[model samples]
Target: MKKDYYEVLGVGRSATKDEIKKAYRKLAVQFHPDKNPDNKDAEEHFKEVNEAYEALSNDDKRRRYDQFGHAGVGSSAASGSGGQYGGASDFSDIFSAVNDMFGGGRSRAGGGAPFGFEEFFGGGGGARKGRASAGIQGTDLKIRLKLTLEEIAKGVDKTLKIKKQVACKECNGSGSKSGATESCKTCNGTGEVRQAQKTMFGQFVNIAACPTCGGEGRIIKDRCTSCYGEGIKLGEVTVKVTVPAGVQDGNYLTLRGQGNTGPRGGAAGDLIVVLEEIPHDLFSRNGDDVVYTLAVSFPDLVLGTKVDVPTLDGAVKLTIPPSTQPETMLRIPGYGIGHLRGSSRGDQYVKVNVYVPKDLSHQDKELLKELKKSQGISPDAHNDPHAKSFFEKARDIFS
Candidate 1:
């Protein structure tokens, strides 16, 4: 059954372009096949969602779906089942746009992107033409690396030397040696086969792509040794990438044309770099704020002193008032990582944790006793319900 596009994205029918994109990106990440393996239903729903997004995300298709519903919007797909959507639409485009949802992320033309010629001119081999026989685009690549908090604080550009695949220079992307290929005879090299069947409803005729040549309309005899008939060779390539400041974990930067080369001189695909922020030993990032845990001695907190504290911008002296309680957080404005596109920087939050003396000598004990007696107080007076005596909690947690 056909489902409404808005329903698939969980958005209202009047959603704007930005809202639609947000919803699609969320669902794509959630129901992506990599995230939900071993579940056939989820995988199917994922594909459906991709298809819905692909159609509605486009202006023309969205208008068509809005005015004519699924029937008018998808009639090409229904009838194109006989063959392909010759020119009006490119099935291969649709397939590549949604292939990530399927376990087989490969495009119909293997690693290459679909060609426009297949959409413009219906090849003689196939009865109906869409993108079924379109040339393929290159493959997308993913690389993961760790980044330090300081590196993320300031944007950086890095040049990485890596290995991947490229089109076979020896064969010129033909997968054959010195023009050793010829038209396939299975379906007369048309790359498609036609058949007619009589049914009760009507004499239904079905037109399908040629299976023998794999819809390429040609056959290779002596394959190229460089790519082993795949028309792509493994090689090393260098790519320069810029890491924007304030980029969070799981954020991706796309470097186009850095992927494997396309067959027959097709354009190369893209390389996606996913950033992973490493936790700093002395600092943590909260949104745009830099946080550091500063330990203050009990005497320092009680006597009131100006102590040096570390911040992203460097060390600054912070004043601690007398009788200051533990767990007091102080903020330094405009000291953290600068907003990637904004004018101001994030603030740095210093969390003060007053440390109580754990090892007390005889003289220290006597001095504490005398001080408490002078104040007419006892150790029990320090008891706090928010996790018995903050000092004890800190000591227990740290030790």
Candidate 2:
């Protein structure tokens, strides 16, 4: 037997069109599939709510509903329509009306309007179809890729073993039991459902996906033994991705159609790989330039000298200008990372560290004593007003 349209919306036959609309809005929000997520009960309820609202919200249909009851009004039950519309009416109508009220782009958490969010923005019109482009896309998956400094500089290829969610071979995403499919009992095969409640705010109704059938508008009487009727399985697969040189950390690479398989054989979503770079112990990168530190003798700082320093290319001799200050920095151009798009390489910088011997030989002590006396300087010269100690001077030297 058909339930009364007013009863479907939990309203009296005398309810005003505004009352019908309000009731439908409440039910649609509560039962939306995105809200219910994977829960079968929520999905089914979601469908029922939409179906009921479809019948009672339109003036013509609502009038017909008042005159002939549920049978005379004809089944619409979705949030918008007259008797002229049916199961194939644009699925987004109810959603669009809700969107106008919500005042925001579609919510990532599934819009508050179960019907309004996904159904509204995902795409729709007043038609159902067999169009080639029509179908659900798979859910995208993410993986973090770690790159070494050298590998990033040179660019590298990596083969990864990743598991993606694919539709079950057993039921093909039908969530069915065996080969037997049945109409959704909760939604009555309309794929939508509605209900009303009295809250502090007022009397309201909610719509949601049909729980009994998970919004497919049909039920699986028997479960697929392999998938237990859920219709998706976890499988492992290997894929190789090429990491381009100069790939920045936190950047993502997308492999199209490499994500989870869509339900009902829809197009596959993309796989997103996030790149992360590992820090190097021997080298520090400053933009394209590399930085290195080499120790030198005090005499080298005063007299100046060429010292061998390690670079990405190899050990190169770095010349310090005469009377070069301790911790002076020198640039060796074209010794750093290569330009991502150009032929040029970045420059490398070398900082000189001047050190005093910890242990003095008899000859060294004599030489230093004579040298200090000749220069009118004492062993405590570092303690003078103008000088700082070796440890404290590193900052000044480097600075």
Candidate 3:
């Protein structure tokens, strides 16, 4: 039996559009083919999630599915077999949706392929037309960008050198030495050729890009010597990228039309910048906030003293109150990383630890022995009602 659309998406039947979209995004990311490479189970789950979202995202399809279950949304309504639910056509929509979720900018142009799936799915070679006729889109490029805590606290701009396919300068991307071409004999200027395939269900007609002209409908009579008639060459270019503040690891920013240029003046591809957070020497990140450990002398903790605390910006003075306990956390407002959205910044947490000397001089031992003779100086004699246990302090730090 087919799984329920709501069940496949892990949502209730009455889920709102926003709720459905949120669930779909979570599931899509979890089971994305890129994240779970070579995992057949995850790939199936991804397709299922896309199928469920497709049926639920649209109000009309959702209403029909709700009234008549699988029959209403299936290929032929009468068959109720769902043959077209997970077909090649749906993959395009699935990729487009994923791109919208992670693209972080403008939508792709009309004829552009999403995530360069054409190479994987044979350019949607099943009944889908017009795309083969249109100019082929260039493949997207992905690069990892490492940022430090300081850089993440305040956004930064970086220039990256990328090597990719650029349009040939000799023939101006036309692939012809004389800048002239003729219509393809195979596809006859249609850019696609049709073929018949026998399947278990029935005979199916498949449409694919023409092999002669590579879907361009035209062929170069005289090939360009520079690019060997491919209309592109591998070259290097510098791209300026502005990384936003508070971007966590695994997060990515998309630069539209900044990837490899399309072959023969087709649509350009996108540049995907994946952010990687470099480990900090003195601090660790917790969500938007940063945690830092401060080591102070025993006297500073007991007698109370102002000490310098390291922040992303610089060192700031932190006042320790009298009788401050060890493992106590202090907060410095607006000293941490900024929020990804909005103007607010997270507070930096300073965890206090008493610094103990590994080796002490005879004079230091004599002074310590003298202080131990005083009342309330010994651990057994020290009794504070407000003092927390070691475990309690550890829990408070995480909380």
In lDDT terms, how accurate is model 2?
Answer: 0.66
Model 3, 73-122: lDDT tens digits are: 87643232234433433444454564465442122222454443232324
- Among the numbered candidates, top lDDT falls to 3
What tens digits encode model 1's per-residue C-alpha lDDT throughout 266-384? Answer: 45778889999998888888998899888888778778889888876678878888877788888888888878887678888888897766899999899888877764344553555
Whichever of 1 and 3 has more lDDT, that candidate is 3
**Deviation from native of the Cα of residue 299 in model 2, angstroms:** 2.9
* lDDT-best of 2 and 3: 3
Give the higher-lDDT candidate: 1 or 2. Answer: 1
Every candidate's CA RMSD = 23.4, 15.2, 22.7
Per-model TM-score, in order, reads 0.56, 0.54, 0.63
Candidate 2 runs further than 4 Å off: 1-101, 104-138, 167-190, 196-205, 218-222, 262-269, 338-344, 373-399
Q: Give lDDT tens digits, candidate 2, residues 230-338.
A: 5667788788899876667797899998888665445677999999989877778887777877778877777888778887777898887777776677899888776
The lDDT for every candidate, in the order shown, is 0.70, 0.66, 0.78
- Give the TM-score comparing model 1 with the true structure, all chains together: 0.56
